[model samples]
Target: MFKSSHLPLEHADKKSWASGGASSSSPMEYPTPLNFYEKPPMFDVKLEQFEQSALDRLRILAEIESCSARGRPWDETKRIVSTLCQKHLRLSSNTAGGDLGIMDTQKEDERRKDHLSHFVLRLAFCRTEDLRQRFITAESTLFRCRFEEATPAERTLLYESRDFKWVKVDDVEKKSLEANLRATLTGFKNIAEQNDAWDRDAFYKVQWSQVPQLVEHRRVFLKKGWAYVPARQQSAIVFREFEVHLRQALNMTNRAMPQMDEDTRLTPIIDHLSQGFLAGVASDWQYEEGDDTTKLRAEQVDEYAKKHWPLCMRSIHDQLKKDHHVKHYGRLYYTLFLKGMKLDINEAIAFWKKSFQGGKVTEDKFNKEYRYNIRHTYGQEGKRANYQAKTCVALLTGDAEYGCPYRFLAPESLQTRLQISYADQGLQSSDIHEILNNKKGSHFNIACTRVFEITHAKYVKKGEGLGQSETVTHPNLYAERSIEFETKKEGPTKVTSKQEDDDLEGIIMQVD
Candidate 1:
């Protein structure tokens, strides 16, 4: 059992947890307090350590949330959570048939990590009701799984260590309640020695409201507003308490959220982590297997836009061509897409410079303000982080032409764009209507994929097009797959620098 004195009282005060204290020089100086769920508190961590621990825990919780939202089976969800805990958090599976020795160094480390990670995530998730609820559900499920798998001795130790004061029914009371209890309790009907079993086993007398799940399922015997719950059903009551406590904690944390805004570094990190949770997992673009983009030149962007770019990228390209300018977000999104398509930095600069020619942006102005951002996307400047293209969720929630068109565009506007863009490809009004319906139903990615299939019906092979099973995630993925389909129809080809420069000149002349 962890000592309460070692536990940080900072969490109890809303302001303290949100505003972490001065940077600790060593881990031993900053020992985390012990808790019921997480035993053996961790100590001595730097700011980076704290941030990373929080991020790791967030990943597990995010995965759990995703699994729940998708209605994945309980066994599969448990399996995934268990695997993640073992791999990332170093927590061992209680059901895996071996007892972790009390003095085991690795076991102690894992326990400390598991304990600290939960508190760290609490700081990030307490800001919103939606986030709090999601975090609560995922964390509750995780704790329940661990509890269920615990060995008999561990379970007894845990139950005794907790503050629960459940009272056991007496022998005379048990005898009187035996018939009702047997009928109401799950798995107690066919006992050969009913009285013997009833006498030997312990039952807690809880308020009827405390075990509502049992009452609803008719699994507990209720009399005079009292619920007679067996040992096996105690988990329901205990987990409910866990949920209530966490909910209250989160509400308190939400009150402290405004203070977090003052810390710019922490605020962005939290926002980004929250966004990542909503975005689901990152997509594997399979860039390792070299594709047609390797041989393509920047000048071929327009040609590729017509045949290979997804609806989102295609919309951005058309807007840039027609208006001869795009907003900052549109430029960032489209430039990133182009870079993903293997357009080098110099070619990207030329493409943007040409696109802005007939607009308000002059070449000198573009260089002064826009050049660094373009280079930054390619990891050639600033942070030099090779940022991946935004995911479907990111695009869906973005503003000012930054988001996915299928999600953000008005129904009529989307319909009109699809009609005009694919008019020669036999796009019917019914097709447009169906896409609109998908968008209404929150199947935005599916709607975009449907547009792709409709535009490239002839090129899509049997059982090869975007089906109900496959969801279009990244614009880059859409572009890569579309290019792959084209490459299948036509043999491999390469673009020379002369061809790229010629295409660039044509684009510039058209703009002029």
Candidate 2:
């Protein structure tokens, strides 16, 4: 709906942004900050640049979703999103100054990357209903933020540049609708005050469908299927229209994606990007000092499993408790997880020692059979691999029982587990439904992250927990984060066992 510098690749000339020497009269000036991605940008791009830009944009969209999922305040979400965009996906306007070294050519390249990346991710995310809706929410929020921050003159230019068919209400028409317009004005106590506001502001009439959110909120005057939208709330029309066009484009793109399979290079990138998004767009994670894991205790394993562990680890812990023994992979997964949580080797031996008692694996057999494997995990025996906790990516393809529950559990099973686990934390049927939907959509990491956020919503609403959730990357991350939020009242207790870190040089040495 907006005039973009973007030109569909099939129709564009061979010259790319970086390559050029032709002096064309119509320079590729994007002209405005906001875009609706009406055309795919034409450019000679290498596969590396294609993948990188797509990822950078995907990060921006993921952050927007995370902010909303964590219930961040709108103003704060805007601030955080702005900072990230400036860092990873900056789109400077034509007039943006040299203080930032934004040359005309550089500006064109930025616009090109922006356009290309949008289309690439559009292809990647268009494959499913869940993906399409997720894409819509993130993209709409991004468009709304950019529209809100644009200068008044730029905003007007944006509207003029687009063919949205918005009709300006005349003074004569305003008088006829003045009473009804005034009715929609909030924070005004008197008719005179409402009249002043109604006269001072402008209004645009658009199809009611284009601004459904405003109509639904009863913030606009609706008559005969048209919405009389006040200037201040006009961004709703922009966002809704963009969303509408994007949804249609995505479905079209989804149909066209099969043709992309012929482009062997691109197919993999698109598939990988889409798969990564479903797994929650992995972010780098590193353990740091002062994490609560240093205080982990053997006796707290059951309670912590209930409160802090990811579904995968929790399932293994439960299996070990009930049966007093786990299969080889589950034992390996859980032992390394406990190690990564900084559980002392002595406590590790003791925890399994106690867990395996009163069952087939007696204490003597646990010491002879299981303790060796636990020590091997810590580099005290065997090849000294000294394994770190498994990542969600690795675990998803690893052993069945210890892998992601979101990836493996039946809908009924997952729902029942979620219901029982979070019943005390105000888990609603809708939350359960959302988790099930994401699971069905194969957004396992996102589903896991949602479970974390929803289950902890009680404390977060009270300003007492980690305000945001990362897609579950590792069991230790889930474990540590849960310990932070769930046990706030108990506080970080005294270290029940050794808190000192093992030597990295010693641990990371070649397997012996």
Best candidate per TM-score, number?
A: 2
**Residue-by-residue lDDT tens digits, candidate 1, 307-366:** 777778888899899998887768777876787677777888889888888999888888
Predict model 2's lDDT versus the native.
0.72
Error of 2 at 246 (Å): 0.4
Clashing pairs in 2: none
lDDT of 2 by residue, 254-303 (tens): 88777776666677777767766645564444333345645568998888
User: Model 1 — which ten-residue stretch has the worst lDDT?
Assistant: 498-507
The C-alpha RMSD in Å for every predicted model, in order, reads 9.5, 7.8
Candidate 1's C-alpha runs over 4 A off are 1-42, 93-103, 186-202, 256-268, 281-325, 345-388, 391-400, 404-512
Clashes of each: 2, 0
> Each prediction's TM-score against the native?
0.66, 0.70
